[model samples]
Target: METAYIETPLGIASISGDEDGITSVSVTKESSEKPSTKIPVILQDGALQLQEYFQGNRTDFDLKLNPAGTDFQKKVWDELLNIPFGKTTTYLDMAKRLGDPKCIRAAASANGKNPLWIIVPCHRVIGSDGSLTGYAGGLWRKKWLLDHENPVKQQSLF
Candidate 1:
């Protein structure tokens, strides 16, 4: 029922929720205006958690989420949560996990509609060919998030 904005590496993320639980989180282009009011008491923690996530100081989110969506979309988003940090999965893979071997398109659609953003980790979804694909926040941001989570550490050349 309330919303707050937090500056992040990708952009300014708009977080919305209530005392019951978090309902939505979406990113936007950079903004200069400050929040009209303080982030609601119920949502301040969630906002801070998101800040930590973008800072690479946190990987797993531990707050409650209440994203609004259809039953099928909820199912797909739940499956997306199973994708671990620093990992990726394909849409076809998600479809199979949803117990429908042919629902790849539907699964992809749900993935695209995920409103929880980083909390639900929809950016982890990719094409079956190991290619980075569609992302509502822009593919560049997706690539940035993936790289942040799975930085390629240099190895010794012995």
Candidate 2:
């Protein structure tokens, strides 16, 4: 595995991957000078795509992903990829789509564990009431991302 750190609007992001594809992306307040492995081309590609996404010039990512997780987590992550850019879904919605209406908590947990971040589109998941909920990168960042994706139409409130 290889790793690299990049600065993002949310925070410093650590990306890791290998020839198989990008494996993980995590956000943190600080950057590590000594990463545990080398920086791979797959991670670099993901970082570049993320930069384009934050600039609002890109909506979809094209890099390959190989996040490490259990079978359920993999299934949840795959479902997350189906969430269109600038759109949102609820935990219950995802759970039901996955054929387990009672697995909302498990769905949320899998969402929280998503390692590919924006590329995986896990931030598109929201509370049942349409409020921002748990986000591994922090709820504030999640709100910012959603707002960035689906900007509200400004109107005069008389």
Candidate 3:
């Protein structure tokens, strides 16, 4: 898989994929890995889309994704994609949608294991009490993303 690193408001984002499609998109505080001299053609769309997302110009991703995971995990990840921009859902809700409320933990596990970061929108999942929780990218980053997608608009004081 070809990999490319780009600077984002969050940090250095590593995007990896091939002709098959984008396989992974991850962020790190820092990385010894050098930025791609040239982003591979197959990965350029995903890279551009991610940049657009961070810029707040794109609400939803429209690139081909080919994440690797078990069937159950894939089901969970697919459900995550249904979460709209600026919206959040609880793990229990996700479990119910998956046809078994008892699978909340399993669903949560799959959410944590999601490989495609912002693209899959796993950060959109929150605790039952609406608290931020269990973001593989870090809770701080999750908060940043949720705020980015749903920033509080200043009201006019007439």
Better of 1 and 3 by lDDT: 3
Give stretches of model 2 more than 4 Å off. 31-39, 151-158
Which runs of model 3 end up more than 4 angstroms from their true locations?
154-158
lDDT of 2 by residue, 5-93 (tens): 77778777788888998998888656554443444665777878888988888999999888999999999999999999889999999
Quote each prediction's TM-score.
Answer: 0.91, 0.88, 0.93
Q: Which candidate has the highest TM-score of all?
A: 3
Clashes of 2: 0
Q: lDDT tens digits, residues 16-105, model 3?
A: 988888899999657676667798888888889988998889999999899999999999999999999999999999999999999999
In model 1, the runs with Cα more than 4 Å from the true position are 30-37, 154-158
